[model samples]
Target: MEAVHEGEIVDVHALIMSFPASNTGFVVPLPSENQECFLSGLKLLFKQAGGIPLSIRIDNLTPAVKKVRGSEGEAQLTDEFMAFKNHYGFKVQVCNPRSGHEKGNVERKVGYVRYNFFSVPPVIKDFDDLTEQLYQKFLIDRKRMHYRKEAIIEDLWACEQKQLLKLPDNDYSVFKQTTIKFNKYNEFKLDQHLIHVPKAKNYSQLYCITFWNEFKVITNEGEVLLSDARPYMRKRRLIPWKDILKDWVYKPRVVGHSRYREYLPARVREYLLTPSLSLRKQRINEIITLLVQYDMKGINEQFYELISKNDEVVSNPYDVEWSQYDALQPIGGENHEGNH
Candidate 1:
């Protein structure tokens, strides 16, 4: 994590998967898997049942739609995706770009895939072997009755398909995928949002956002992966760093901006680096949450109060304050010694 300061590249990506009562996943693939094929498979599965959902809920995925700007009252839906939705007739809704609770269904799906399949997928060099491995996972492992739900995932999927929305007549090509470039300050523009990435990836192209629509930046060579949304820009808003500012508080000489520090109250700035690591970290995260909850000013004011009581701010008000005893004796020593 310290590499974030040394200007290392940070990548994050979001994964969306599906599971049934079998407690096993119907899909699992590497982050770099072919998105077109994956979406086609999903369309096929939904077709088998009936159609797509009346409304599809997803995290903010660029290929599907640009994030909806709540303040602006709408988002810029990509041209290709607009057509896809028009064809499918499934109204797509996004979770709060930052709120996981809004999309618990998909979150659980991701968990199941990671634990039950991908963690131990049978690997092979050939595509045929890979397909066979996937088939075993879907048919053999995923078909078994679940322990807790006591029902087969296959059965649940069948029912879900029966009620899903239908695919459209026209073919839809997936987004070729896009790259995120961080500015000199190690910040990248995610639509109207501004996100700070590690400086390492500056001017290099190794990051991309996935179709499933969550902020998980991933590197091309698989060296580092992290979770962060593309930031939005709201004028005069000082967003604090989210949960990660703990790393910054203890460093003696710091330079940079964070979601947590951006919105710090004018008064609180003086004390931001004073708190203990854990306490300061928690405070930083809380301020970020508060910034999301209220405006930056409101959150900063709260911060001003949060630390007001324990104002043990060790500022060197006088870097060269002389003790009274030293001040009185120091003048005589040089002169007396020289005379002797």
Candidate 2:
């Protein structure tokens, strides 16, 4: 019981169900069902049929539309229903209350199906599987006129699909929704630590952040996962080794005489907290080489001689301290290896 514009005939094959908009015809994909699945189904229909209706006329099922605005007693809809309408680009024009006249076209269509096609309800299988099967049944076979213009419902649907509204750009990662408040740092936390987001858009909108990849900050505005860690990660921020202390902590960090100065090369220490595995291993080896050289310097001048070759990196030749260490004559000359 739907209206097709002048010169258009009702496409009789849309899935049959008691419609919401105009009790007159079936909703191509059951709109009274789950919003996500229902919209997905409708989009498929256009992909096959070729366009969305300027509007869908229905009988106004409660599940489809909530309440009417202004006409409070008359009709109003829920937020979810409103989102559905906007998403599909449809104007839901409800037919008169209980007036079968509004649905004459689809009424005949549904009855026509029962009389001409299935005497019993289609057998239950997995719902998604069933939908796919039925779609194949109608879209492919019913559309073939056996090769004249080579036209079918699929071509018609492809035409309709081109006219459909664009879907949202970014996918919502199916997050559990939560209300979060920003901290004084002007950043939000999914658990501990900070992550960046559009500062202005905070608190006003809801967020959907993933716990594991805190970098993937999401919002209802259709944002894709982006790394905003740099702005929040300050360089050489002095941290009490105790604050991050744990099994991860080591004797190298016992406050004021921070072992970090001796343990890690300056560049490596700067980025070590969030380093790649290979980089961490490489830095560890570099630190171990320094420790070995420093220990050997105590036993023999050869170690000091070998280490002095790296003076451009480890020491300032212009610094007076290197000359003082050079002046130290051996106290007992046990002379472990070679020249002192």
Candidate 3:
């Protein structure tokens, strides 16, 4: 599928699964026509349908067919796709080479979707939101009478749903795993897109799990350090400013000289370079560490609130009771660390 997204042309694969018996269709947008996308799309479709079909008829696409056998023989399914089929307990039926007519049910469904959903050239801000709207539209359309079945499509789907295989006890993780080394700038490139990893050491290896909608980087022990929504724009750099601050805290002086300093809120920049505050290395480190624990916006609010008090004497930024800051609270509750 081709569409304009965020002022750029995006080329993606459309996975359309059609149930001829009920005239029901499930559509999933994939990043590519690769093995991972093929499996992920199917997994998402099954999850939405709540069950697997007894058998799935697929086109002889490159992702699914490693080698096409004779018309009478079973086409060799790619190992990854084969494993997915086995996990879902579904029979695989492949169409003959150049024989799209065999999967006409889904082909027409794709056309219908393209006409109804993509015809207007959607202004997509979020890829997930677009897919969700498409799915809801599909459901609403199913309330109509079936073209030839002489019954409501949704009603017919109810009957077809009864014959589907039950969902497996465990859900599948749909991602393509890769290892990448960070550059001196703590940046890594994926599919020509640059991603900045804050506080990452140069030459350190990071594991990435690429999904259809997003990608994540994890430590060697599998703790997720960074995650970003996959960008359609080529060669785009995704930088998390919060993560960037993790590195800036080590060099307090550089924070003032960096080009991003101007981007910081005025209160945060002023507090960092407050003339009245001691710039001793230990004091700088303490302020940096504390600021990291609290968002600049929240800290700025506190700064203004305190500065407004005529009765209170505020000398140094560190003089504030940062531990009492609301934003510093841990996710579950407050931290029980020693007094600051």
Candidate 4:
């Protein structure tokens, strides 16, 4: 599926599932067709359907099916997908290669959903928001009369629900676990994104647990170093500036080459880029301390005001009267004077 996401026309994956008996259909839009997305989509489908299907007729998608044996032989499933099936205790019914008629219902439902639900090429601001909207559309669609059956689609679906396998006590853990090494920047590359793991040593091995929407960097001792939302676009970098700024105070030279440098306010960036190494270190240290009490926006605004008033770079952190920035003060009325 192609949709306008954040004003960019990017390709998205749509998982379409349809029940032949009730003529009920489900469609889940995913960011990618990775194993995590495929498995997570199945989990979402099961949740929406209220129970797991006894047998799912599927095409030879790479996420699930690694290889199609032949026209009649059983398809080989990926290890993660095979484990997922075992956990849910469902049966797999792989459709034969080039045999579109075998699962014609879902194939047609895909076209129906593409035209009826996504005909306008939805302007998606948030992926989850789009998903919720589609789910509501499906619910409304179910209220209509079935194409072939006498009863409404929702009514037939209600009767078919009782025949489904009982939902398991616990949901399956859908994630892809792998070992990754942090680069010299204390960041690891996943897809085209550089995910920073603060405090992680450079060139160190760590466990990366990837989910459909987020990923976690784990230490060797199983300590979670960072758990952050994964970026959807390519060539993106996820940097926790506040956390990394603590480390940057010592390595002030590298601040110039930082990918996040341009993102900082102009005055703040100039303050950090000063030729005086000691001043840069002192300023960043103060900024880091201030960040503990206030957000980046507040800090940036205060710095902008201070620079505008002084008309010259504040040589020392102690020169500024921190109390004057009362509007940006932290809650609970904690005195910040002695902290400097």
Model 1, 1-340: lDDT tens per residue? 0001111111212234443323434442222323443454455444433456677666666555555658867666666666666777778666666788886756776675556654422223223334345556556654666557757767766665665555667666544356776776776665456666665554356575544233556667755455642231111222224434445645423413443332233333434444355455444554444545565444334543544433444343212232542364342232222100
lDDT of 3 at 66: 89
* TM-scores of the models, in the order given: 0.39, 0.34, 0.59, 0.64
Better of 3 and 4 by lDDT: 4
lDDT of each: 0.47, 0.41, 0.68, 0.74
Choose 1 or 4, whichever is better by lDDT.
Answer: 4
Query: Candidate 3 on 1-340: residue-level lDDT in tens?
Result: 5543322345656788899999999888766666667788888798778799999988788877888868567689887777778888999898888898988988899899888887654434345655686689889989999999789999999999999999999887767889877777888897677789888783257788887667888987887889887654342222245565656656656766764554444444544564442353343454345555554445444655544342234543344444554366432221321110
Can you give the lDDT of residue 160 in candidate 3?
A: 93
Ranking by lDDT: 4, 3, 1, 2
What residue runs in model 1 are displaced by over 4 Å at the alpha carbon? 1-15, 19-25, 28-51, 126-132, 146-150, 168-170, 173-340
Per-residue CA lDDT of candidate 2, range 1-340, in tens?
A: 2111111111122355332222212224231233333444555554444445666666665545565334446566656566656765767777666677887766765675555434423322223433464555554344544233455534544554555455444432322345546666656764455655556354465454432112355556756534443222121222222232231334323322443222222222332333344443343343345544343223223433543454454554222343453455242222211111
Model 2: weakest 10-residue lDDT segment is 2-11
Task: Give the C-alpha miss distance for residue 68 in model 4, angstroms.
Answer: 0.8
Tens digit per residue, CA lDDT, model 4, 96-189: 8889999999989999998897765564545665777788999999999988878999999999988888888987888888988777788779
Best by TM-score: 4
Candidates 1 and 3, the one with greater TM-score: 3
- The whole-model C-alpha lDDT of candidate 1 against the native structure comes to 0.47
In model 3, the Cα lDDT at residue 174 comes to: 68
- When 1 and 3 are scored with lDDT, the better candidate is 3
Prediction 3 TM-score vs. true: 0.59
